[model samples]
Target: MIRTATPADVPVIHAMVRELAEYEKALDEARATEEQLREALFGERPAAFAHIAETEDGEPVGFALWFLNFSTWRGVHGIYLEDLYVRPDRRGGGHGKALLTELARICVERGYERLEWSVLDWNEPSIAFYRSLGALPQDEWTVFRLTDGALGALGAPTR
Candidate 1:
């Protein structure tokens, strides 16, 4: 079962975020805490939203955290999926697709113009899965980021 996550789901969601960070080789950089997760996801004015994946009997195995984005060209809202993960043993089932489809349904119902996300270039399995879902890579554009300390230094480029 895939459903919108509530405040009570924070612990499991935090654990899965850690697992995903570890899998992506960024465990040491993860700074998420239960309180932070709860506040950002369930606070008075939420910064993001999540969807939980559960078994027939109600066991959360994974989740996806996403939020809205605006595209000036489209003049409509878009959903940016920040994270989508399932446990190793839970792969090969339909959970990932189900989660993605549910999000797509929201996009349709709410008149969103598109849904977008980024995956590591080296993660072939995820790339293939996304392609299989009818998403074509936008080869014309490149992704860039300036995180942590570098973000503040962006205006001071040096030779």
Candidate 2:
């Protein structure tokens, strides 16, 4: 079952975040603390929305984090998925597609113009799965990010 996450789900979410980071070879970059996560998604002003996929026996198998973005050109809200993960052993059971489909439902409910996310170029399997779901990759755009290390190396004076 897919449901919105609550503050009570923080512990499991934290653990899953670490697990996902490890899977992506980014364990060291998993910097979220339980308190931080709790405050972000469950705080007075929610930073984002999160959902967990659990089984009939009540074991969480996957999660997805997303937020809304405004697109001026489209003149509508877009559902931007920041992260989606399922345990490697639990994959091939349709959990991923179910999660994505749920997100699509949310978009329709909210009248969102788009549902979008980025996938690592080398993750061919995921690319194929997304393509099968009728998602097209924007080959014309390049994604860029600013890392803390990169910022530090810039030697800008602190406030």
The candidate maximizing lDDT is 1
Q: Candidate 2: deviation at residue 8, Å?
A: 1.4
Global lDDT of each candidate: 0.93, 0.89
Give the TM-scores of the predictions, in the order they appear. 0.93, 0.92
lDDT of 2 by residue, 1-159 (tens): 888888888898889889988977889999999999898898999888888888888888998988999999999999999889888888988888988989999999989989999998888999999999999999999998777989777777867
For residues 24-130, could you state the per-residue lDDT of candidate 1 as single tens digits?
A: 99999889899999999999999999999988989898899999999999999999999999998998888999899999999999999899998988899999999
Clashing pairs in 1: none
TM-score of 1: 0.93
lDDT over C-alpha atoms for residue 126 of model 2: 92
Indicate the TM-score of model 2.
Answer: 0.92
